[model samples]
Target: MRHQIASVDADHTSYLYEWKLNGRWNKLGATVNSDFVPMKPGSAEEFILEHYWAITGEAMLTRWNTRWSMCHGV
Candidate 1:
């Protein structure tokens, strides 16, 4: 299984959307907008990790968390 950063918004507010799947198109939940702050640094990694636990299905958390923690030390 793998994860992808689908989209991000940083104009006025910092918001991110991530799509997680195993060689297929599967949608995971999105992260809550972290309020609007101009000139703030954006982090795709932070966005994905923040919302990874809320992904759809039962085992998504286990699969994603295990992989993420292993590689990124989450």
Candidate 2:
């Protein structure tokens, strides 16, 4: 699987990302899971993120990074 960061919000609260699967983009769909809160400076927030991939009538789960780094310049 391959992915690219499509976009990120100005406050870095939301990230728009996309993934390529089976030679296509967003074929299985993508999910962005988080608390949906802005990060504080020099601090980390608790986040629950997961990515679901559908393959051959089965669902496969992929965990995202629990810690999201605050963007220095957005």
Candidate 3:
């Protein structure tokens, strides 16, 4: 499995991806400006997404654990 981080700049959006390789998260590839305004998926090229830490502490922890396990093939 892999992990991805999404961020927005002005009117543009970007996604950065990483893979857990050798116990370390390493940079992979990214997609940018692949959507239209008001937020509709556009065809620019690339893949992405997931929300950030806006949930409860426990929920955040659970999310991380789940992702960690998936990355490790656990």
Candidate 4:
């Protein structure tokens, strides 16, 4: 599986990045210009986590819980 990050920039431009992951993509989220900063080595997770919350209006923990429960039937 892969985790994909997609966003639209301030100029209405779009970008995407993909990373391998062990889980499926279901409760995937989207980010916008305000949600992200410059991406550098070793900062992918931090950037995604920050943008995830900014876009979802939920904490990372809560979003993960909800996604897990919904997808895993837990």
Candidate 5:
């Protein structure tokens, strides 16, 4: 319920007075070197990429009234 959002500087420190809130104090004045590169998780990427396929399969199964039982190895 924040009426106004405070901006953070390049150092990642919020202008709000509570620096220790949500571990902000620990991450303050930190820097990421040039070697820092971002990449997506493989499982997440696969799930996101195959979302349409999952939906299509569900639609097809529903239309055909197919029943599926999945096996989980204990």
Candidate 6:
């Protein structure tokens, strides 16, 4: 994997329609593959993908936690 330091250029949300990955807007029913697969039992995907939360405005003090389902399949 290539690593570089730059400002975040994407947006993430609970709904797939509002998500932007890799600097491209994700439309409904669109899919993108990545090398970052969740490992057995506990892995990085769990902590990163399991929960949805947002914080914004005024020094980013306010945060909203959104509930969603976690899917595990191959």
Q: How large is the C-alpha RMSD of every model relative to the true structure? A: 15.3, 14.2, 12.3, 12.4, 18.2, 15.1
Task: lDDT for model 3, please.
Answer: 0.38
**Considering TM-score, which of the candidate structures 3 and 5 is the better prediction for this target?**
3
Model 1: lDDT to the true structure? 0.35
- CA error at residue 1 for candidate 3, angstroms: 3.2
10 residues in a row with least lDDT, candidate 1: 65-74
lDDT of each: 0.35, 0.34, 0.38, 0.38, 0.31, 0.33
Q: Report the C-alpha lDDT of model 6 over 1-74, residue by residue, as the tens digit.
A: 12223322243233333344676544432223222332333443333443443322341322233334433221
Give the per-residue lDDT digits (tens) of candidate 5, residues 1-74: 12222334442322212134453332222222223233334554345445655643433322221123322221
Best by TM-score: 3
Q: Which stretches of candidate 5 lie over 4 Å from their true place?
A: 1-51, 54-62
TM-score of each: 0.22, 0.20, 0.31, 0.21, 0.18, 0.22
Q: Give the TM-score of candidate 2.
A: 0.20
What value of lDDT does candidate 6 attain over all alpha carbons? 0.33
Roughly what TM-score does model 1 have, to 2 decimal places? 0.22
Ranking by lDDT: 3, 4, 1, 2, 6, 5
* Candidate 1 lDDT over residue span 1-74, tens digit each: 34544334552222233344554444333333434333212444444534764544432322211111111111
Q: Write the per-residue lDDT of candidate 3 for residues 1-74, one digit (tens) a residue.
A: 55556655554444445666677776544444434433223322111122433443333322110112122312
> What is the full ranking by TM-score, best candidate first?
3, 6, 1, 4, 2, 5
> Which ranges in model 1 have alpha carbons more than 4 Å from their true place?
11-26, 36-74
Q: What digit string (tens of lDDT, one per residue) describes model 4 on residues 1-74?
A: 34544344453323333333455333333343343344343465446767664543334332221111122211
